[model samples]
Target: MRGGPYLLLLVAGTLGVGRGLDGQLGSPCHPSGRCNVRFSECQDNICRCSGTGVPSAYNNRCLPVADGLKGYCEENVQCTVPHSHCRRFSKECECVEGYVMARDRSVCLPVSRLGEPCLERAQCKESTECSPSLGVCVCRGISYEYDGKCVTDHISNNWELTVVTVSPAAGSQLLAHNRWLLCIALAALVHAGVR
Candidate 1:
């Protein structure tokens, strides 16, 4: 963004990574500062980007920052995902406590139990928590994980969340569980800046 169009072409001419462009993210570079990659510098023997330039989970690529859940950031201001903020450890946009990315990936919504999707334990509703292996809301304590809501005596608490009572309905959710996990993993890769 600093230079004219010809400057991009000149920098793009460098070889070995990212469309053969020097200063292209994740490309190997020297200790001497290179003007090609913006907001990036050679660190730990690799060309790493800072700020909006996010590295992939594999650290293979760097992507421009955005306001989505996958956007790379160091501060809360960098992300604008609904009900979301920058997570310090991951350095990416994530839902605030008591919230998680919706199934549609558009917004962060309150977390509930009984198969509602979640990323962390705090997102789950009371008496429930996010399951690390399953990536869905699961019952805690003495509750049962039936339908889309947890129950103590198999009695519905009458939660507004979509409820399923039939055996087939619960069976169908098995596939959904896998799908949610896949989505979470993909989001993580993109969150790391795979884009």
Candidate 2:
């Protein structure tokens, strides 16, 4: 009877018919077979997939994980999208340098175009400014000004025209200055004629 019980236990163990002595469930998949797919692993004796899990995404069985920019992931490998990386603390995908999170917070988009609304300079395209007053992207430099609709400039050809409103006293001073210049020019001409 003692031998019989031992033989029964041995057979059960060989066949994997019940829990092991440690009271743990046997793994359904072989150790080598487990984690066969990318970003997949045997967790709690079960094969679990990671990442976005899109069709034919991983190992041809589990869904593919999203890329780092927009997908939720636990590891970098789980991110399948380009220019993306996994954030360990957040367990989410994020964009790399030179990319920005879209307004939807799902995908990484390029910086804003000219005249597009923006919250930060990084959100705008290169050499552009996020207009603080209008909250829109605009060209850099003092030449550009935000009108009601679009950005405008005053430069024409190589010369820049500047219009300024002057008080009465300033206007008279400018007129006198011009007159003095004219008189000086006439004197120079007379002196040249005598020479």
Candidate 3:
């Protein structure tokens, strides 16, 4: 009976062989069948997800490919269920309004020109020129608007034309003057030759 006190002290001082207050076996995963390799913890059952699959080191989630699929979320975060898009750099998923998937399927863009209200040159198409007053890009042929209606032409006010007229009477008078001078010169030359 004297050894009973010493044995009790030895059992109390035992290391790594006692059960938790809740009687959990070893770790939460061993008893609950759920493990979080990424977080290195037995799930507290709050966000209960099966950790049986491949473990992810980055997010510590069940799936190994949760972060992204390479270039798809390079600059942007990977798209999640609630978020429309994922931005890789910021690591956030957000919804982009008025922007739809482009033809290439890699980028999201506005549906049409009307979708974006253009107030500057950069917002217009390459062929179009921006008119800030109207807050949109007008095509080359599209006329500018005055009041409420479109003006067919907004030509520069400095344009001018020179009017030229041909007078046959003036031409005939000049021709006669030339003939009189020629005859007088011819007469003088003949007189000098005779001398």
Best candidate per lDDT, number?
1
lDDT values for all models: 0.65, 0.58, 0.43
How does candidate 2 fare on TM-score? Answer: 0.34
Residue-level lDDT tens digits of model 1 in 1-195: 667787877766544333313445566655554535556667754677765566645454555666588667866655757688888898988888877786666678786666877776766876787888999878887877666656675433332233456588766786577888656656555544545
Query: Candidate 3 local accuracy as lDDT?
Result: 0.43
RMSD of each: 22.0, 14.1, 20.9
lDDT of 2 by residue, 1-195 (tens): 679999988896655422222322222433434444445555555445554453242224554565446566766666665666778788778877767876666556556767887876768775577888999888876435444233332222223233579999988897787988656555555544522
By TM-score, highest first, what's the ranking? Answer: 2, 1, 3
Q: Which TM-score value belongs to model 1?
A: 0.30
Q: Show where candidate 3 strays beyond 4 Å.
A: 1-45, 48-116, 119-123, 140-195
- Give the per-residue lDDT digits (tens) of candidate 3, residues 21-57: 2323223333333333333334453322343333333
lDDT agreement of model 2 with the native: 0.58
Candidate 3 least-lDDT 10 residues = 16-25
